[model samples]
Target: MKVRTDAKRDEILEIARGVFLELGYERASMAEISTRVGGSKATLYGYFPSKDALFLAIVNRLAEQYVLPATERLEQSLDEDPRVALQRFGEQFLTFISDAEAVAAYRVVVSEAAHSDIGESFYESGPKRTVESVARYLEGAMDRKHLRRADPAIAAQHLLALLAHGEPWHQYFLRKAPSPTRAQIKRIVERALDVFLNGYKS
Candidate 1:
């Protein structure tokens, strides 16, 4: 039996990501990925049980790479002004989701959601975890009297919603607009923080 190494697993993930992006979730098959990886279907299956599982793994990886760092910064900056901390996190969060890979994965998940549980799985693996992390930070802020007392989870959702509002990424997701520039993201985050702090400041 061959030893499963992290390098090999990463290679498989990279290849699978490309396949999914090029062919989409419904059209991309394990067989095709296996062929592309220069490996047998059994070997590929050993790493990822199904297409849904593979796709979820990709989402999880992306979240770890992008979302986790932003949330970590939010946690670390707890001593800073709420507006400053949130502005930094909001900018990073918007930038990550607006990425081409993230946008493509979102398209796949939305398209496959009605047909299977991939959407739920994707949410569980990625968005849900990020939300929980943000909620924890918000809860800490509330405890410190930096923000008003409220349901942290709901507050986190509201803050994130505000951050995403009217961004070009929403239209880009629908192929109607281009990816937002850094200037646009900075403007959006500042506006969002202004409104959020106005409502929630303690």
Candidate 2:
């Protein structure tokens, strides 16, 4: 048996991302991914047991590469003005979720949700993680008297919900509009931060 290397796994994931993007989850095939990766189907299966697993891995990878790190920065910057830090986080989170690749992955998850566990898996791996991260940050802020005492998890949910308010999120999910522009996102973040701080300020 051949030993699996991180390099080989990453290479396979890279090819798989492009293939998945080009053909989409329902249509993309392991054989095609293996061909692009210069590997056998067995090798592909060795790395990822099934197509769903591969797709989930790709989604999680993208989240880790983009979302997690950005949130980590938010946590690290907690000493900054709470409003400023939260505005930055809100903008970052909205921007990350509105990316084309992220939206595509979200569509794939929604499409497969009824038939498979992929949707639940995505929630656990992606959005849940982001929520938990923000919750932690909020908890810390509460402890420091940056915000009034409240349920951090609920506070985190409120923050995200406010950030996602209005037509940009709704219209995009409905396929009626494109991702929000930087200026639009900035306005949204500013408005959300105003409401959030007013409600939570210690």
Candidate 3:
């Protein structure tokens, strides 16, 4: 039996990410992933019990590397002005999700959601946690009177939606348009913040 190690787990994840991107979730097979990783299917099962579990792990790993840090930093910015704090968070959020790898993962999740629970699993593992984190920050802002009283959870959803709307990123996600420039990201974030603050500012 192959002894499981973090290195092996990471190798599996990295290889599986490529397979999923290349073939999408439905078409990508555990056998293909095992073959790519140079391991038996039993060895792959030892690391990840199922394909859904493996996919969620990849998504969670990406979230931990990027999204979680940005949300955690939101706490550090609590003393700053609401606009400043939100602008920083929005820009970081947009930049990460607009990344090619991240977009590819989203595409996989969306495509597979109708047929399986992978979409719900992905949301529960990554997006739901992000929404909850942002909601906590917004709750604090409301208490500090920087923002008007409202449902922080709903506000967080609205802010995320606004940030995601219209952009080279949105265009890219829909039609394989070119990757967004930094200037385009900054402009998009600024516009999102403008609309968010106008509605929520105290």
lDDT of 2 by residue, 28-124 (tens): 9999999888879999999999999999999999988888987898888778888888877778778888888888888899999999999999999
Per-residue lDDT over 15-88 for candidate 1, one digit per residue giving the tens place of the 0 to 100 score: 99999989987789999999999999999999999998998898899888888999998988889988888988
At residue 49, candidate 2 shows an lDDT of 95
Error of 1 at 110 (Å): 1.2
Order the candidate numbers by TM-score, best to worst: 1, 2, 3
Q: Count backbone clashes in candidate 3.
A: 0
Error of 2 at 121 (Å): 1.2
Query: In order, what lDDT does every prediction score?
Result: 0.88, 0.87, 0.88
Tens digits of per-residue lDDT, candidate 3, 1-202, equal: 5578999999999999999888987889999999999989999999999998999899889989999999999966777898888888888888888888888888878888998899889988888999999999999989989999999999999999898864554596877865677888888988888888999989
**Model 3: which ten-residue window has the lowest total lDDT?**
165-174
Better of 2 and 3 by lDDT: 3
Prediction 3 global C-alpha lDDT: 0.88
Which residues of candidate 2, in runs, are more than 4 Å off? Answer: 165-167
Better of 1 and 2 by TM-score: 1
Q: Candidate 2, 178: how far from true, in Å?
A: 2.7
Please state the error at residue 177 of candidate 3 in Å.
0.9
